[model samples]
Target: MRLNFSIKTKIILMNMGILIPIIIFIYVTITNNLYSNVIKSNIDLLTKESYNTQVYISNYIEKDKGVDIETNFVHKAPLINTYLSKKLNYRIQIYDKNGDIMTDSVANRVTLFDKDITNAIKGNKAYVVKKIDGNIYILFSSPIYLKDATLGCVRYIYTLDIEEKFINNMFIIMGILAFMSILISWLLSKLLSEKIVGPIKKLKTVSQKVTKGEYDNRIKIRSGDEIEDLAETFNVMSESIKDYVESLKEERQKQKKFLDNVTHEFKTPLTAIIGYSEIIPKLKKQSDIDESLVFVKEEGIRLLKLVEELLDLSKLGKSEFKIDRKKNNLKEIIEEVLIIINPRLKKYEIEIIKDLCDIEVLIDKDKIKQVILNVLDNAIKYSECTNINIKLQIENEKVILNIIDDGIGIAKENISRLFEPTYRVNNLNSINNNGNGLGLCICKEIMKKQNGDIKIKSNLQEGTSIEIIFEGN
Candidate 1:
């Protein structure tokens, strides 16, 4: 099983791992050393002051030099107690050389012997004790000197409750500071994580888009750091992908064009062979040898023409048909086409109506002628009517050639596919004699090669018109 942790939780854990120990160490150090130092400094100051006061009183008493020890000392001790008590709010005790307290400031009576005072008297230093009365005190005893000899001891007692309060307050302040520091550190970690991870999240999403073939998408980070360099690289990759896609598209188009042209070229010769074979049996049944010979000759010539067209189409498909293009008279070329197609016109009883206007174009003449012949031959084969109209006009610096035929026209559904290889219009009348369904396809390819286009308009059972437009020089 995997344990899941939220981002915030993980960040908090990491911060705690790093900073919690440091905080603990700092807090411990502050509470122990800092508190001890503060209490020690205060206690030292108070101890020194208490010792000085004791010495001051001891010096005055020893310097008095009075002969009456009991009466004079009693009277003077009360005065000293009253004066010291009014000045210092601490309990002061005067001890004799034998470690018995002689005077007490609080009660103005003889003091009791205590262990802390005895220790202080023996060492001439301060001593600390916690009494059974639940009070902690520091006791300091200084010797009373009389001409460089110890006479007695003055002991001062100070309570430790005030220092304990000071230590408690310091602890509270440190605890509060620790809490604030942790809060601030947590917020800073959160903000820093968001700033760093936000761009990473965006980059992940954009990377997913790129995986899904959206090469146009890009990450737009302006961090001016390594992430910015990554964004620039991503943009460059998108551009490279776009270029590769375009190249693939161009390659596919070229492949389709090649297949279309090759299939069209093969169909023309196959159609010629089939047409001549169909005519052979009929010619054999004729009794007139001359007419039979003439029919055979005609079929043979048609086969030859088909073969030549196939060879030319094959060369062009391979990109080997080198063109020496120059300006040509459009009128003269149309007349030449009329001469070549005259035989078919007579056989089909088709009348040609020409509406030629003065036009000149720069193109490969032979290829243009082939394109026109293919279209006209298709019209003659599919159109059962006797009239075919050819028109040439100039418009917008273009040469437009329209071939209209009164045939069983193409169906609307098939018009779009007419230029696809082997896509025959489903015409029942000319199904057997439809030649190859490649003429229009070849014409379209040739037009495309010359930077021209062919458009068609037709209605079923009415007529068909094909418009070939070429850019004019």
Candidate 2:
């Protein structure tokens, strides 16, 4: 299996790396200091004893004649060898002026780096550590000066066997303690990492669940630190994402219903146009042929109108749709829409009453007229009245065009979402059923593109009123 280097494991390894070296260095430093102190104390004792022997021989020669007195003193120094050896644990040697070992207090074995007699006679004290018969020892040599004449030299050789054994036992014990400390540090680091990394692991798992669309999963941590802050932020993000997803699903359902309705709306006119065209060609009677031809023409026109409106809606949805705004009179655009609706107004005996003004504004002429035509078309389509009032009034630096019709008005419940894409009034009379349900929606978008707005108010059976607003230059 592949080993995952988790945060817990990393923390443990880092702790051990820092802790083990510190423990080992401390143990080694204390042991070395203790060993050095013991070595220094032993060397001091040996030097004091050696100094006393040198002073005794020098005084004895000063009292008696020279070489004979030194010879007798060298022999006398060895007589106390058993007492010095047992007391100080050192080997002593006395050399004559000729570099000969005249008397030795040690056994047949000697431990020295080189012959110390020649160097000592040249008036230099010498000392060295050497390995003799696989045993480590130190040799210290000092010259005895009698006035200006050299008498002899004294040498002391000693071993640190006892101190070496003591420090070795310290090494073994310290190694055991260091290992124990490392193990304890690793365990403590493990426990600490669990407390630190445990909440983070839970956050990961909950985030994974949220990724898989289970947005309800929340990271519940009580650490009361930055980790808790992270969990709280994560919970908020999940809720936001869930709300966004739900809104998208609702929008998707709306688009689906719109498509179904559009297919049916388009198919109805296409089927009628196709059927009437075939019938007009086959009919023998002139009235029947004329009636069939008129039906074919009307249905074909409606199908074309629906396709054009749908195309306009799509282009408005795009960010790339550009408009050319020029200075124009609002009355002219209204006049254009009024001309389009004149034939229908005459057919329904609906009078067109205009209360407009010469309001000049910056607007796209053709696009603005399309919005006016659509709103006027709805006023004509969904209502029946003897007169349709088209009035324009300026208020608060805005040009407001009000289109009022006394007809079957919309229920208050449906007025709020009247401009939603592909939305239609379900309870419309049979004569107004030819709508594609997106005319008012396109009207709203067109007005918005020109930096304007549309508002509508109506009551059941009373009339509907629509206001188109534009910023006055």
Candidate 3:
């Protein structure tokens, strides 16, 4: 079976694996050196004390002249035992130069059966020994000379169980310390790994969200380090991508609107041209030449207007139409629009009510004129009422113009899309008579260029109000 581990777990394990060996190695090195030094010091102290005790006993025995060695040492055995017992925490023994144990702290007298006694008799200073009974001890011996004649030797024995116990205890403590150190190291590794990997996991999740097209998703990490910097960069990148996508969407919308408007405008003019051209020859026998010429001129003019609007819309779509702005009287501009549309207004029986305000605004004069003409023309074509009210007012440092009429009003559903090119309102009477749907769209664009906006309010069979706002100078 394959092993599966999360990234966090794997990081923890890897860190532990690297750090545990180093910790263990360091602990072992330190503990081994410390324990070795302690044990060696204790052993050396015990050996030195045993050697000194043997030397002291031999010198005292040799000091007596013409005395039986056994009797003299036997009498002093109690004093030696008292001294050795207080100084060394172990059983001590004394042996003669002939390898015969003379006195023992644990026994009155003893025979030299241990190898330590045999070795001591051969003038060994100090040596460690292990008896058959598994007792470990250190023995030291020294010779006693009486006027160049070897009389006897003295031996001392010290048990080593205390040192053994000390070493065993140290081992146990080291084992416990090692285990605790490993545990603490593991825990610390886990914590540090989590701190490092937690943000990475969040980043992974955010990346997946972005991959799924959720460009607005962001990662929040404030580590004050490289990880935090990485998250900040990711957020910036996501925002940039989102902005680019929105810009692309807007461009596509503009392109679609431009194509639809151009198609609609061309279709009407082309149809009129073909229809009039087809009817011209047939009507020649019944119509005067001048009337036919006028009909042709009207169609030609209509086609020319369509071409002009299409070209203007295309230039605007390219973002190449620069506005030539100057301070101008908005009232004078409206008056000029009214004069231009006078023939249409009279023909359509549309009444004009102008509520002009003296407001000067910075705008492109020709562009503002086109905006006014398009909106008023649309109103005159759709309004069933004879009176069309044009209101101008200044408020909040802005010039506001409202063109209202009792027109075949726009439906509620179409009101929102009124400024969308080629999106005509679904009223046949208005659609049949109104200008191309691009009128409102063009007005909206022109108003936007002038640092202004256009808005509409309408209900079916009521009136439609078109409002324009311009920046006041």
For 1-473, candidate 1 gives per-residue lDDT tens digits of: 99987555676779977888898898788778965785577578767776676566656666667654334444566667667767888787777667766678877543545665665556465555445367556665666544545546666776778777877887888789888988988888887766556666677688889888899898899887777888888889888988998999987886665555455443433443454455546554555445444544554565566566555554545675444467888778778666556556766788999898768788777667767777777777776767889999888888899989988887788788877665655554762444455677667767877778999999888988989999877
Question: Model 3: per-residue lDDT, tens digit, 356-446?
Answer: 9778889988677767766776676566667789999988988899999887777788778777776766553763553356767777887
How should the candidates be ordered by TM-score, best one leading? 2, 3, 1
Each prediction's RMSD to truth: 42.9, 36.0, 39.8
What residue runs in model 1 are displaced by over 4 Å at the alpha carbon?
A: 1-322, 431-435
Q: What local lDDT score does residue 5 receive in model 2, on the 0 to 100 scale?
A: 82
lDDT for residue 384 in candidate 2, whole number 0-100: 63
Instruction: Please give the range of 10 consecutive residues that has the lowest summed lDDT in model 3.
Output: 264-273
Off by over 4 Å in 2: 1-256, 259-309, 315-318, 433-437
Q: Which sections of candidate 3 miss by over 4 Å?
A: 1-260, 263-309, 315-318, 431-435
Q: What TM-score, computed on C-alpha atoms, does each candidate reach?
A: 0.37, 0.38, 0.38
lDDT of model number 2:
0.74
By TM-score, how accurate is candidate 3? Answer: 0.38
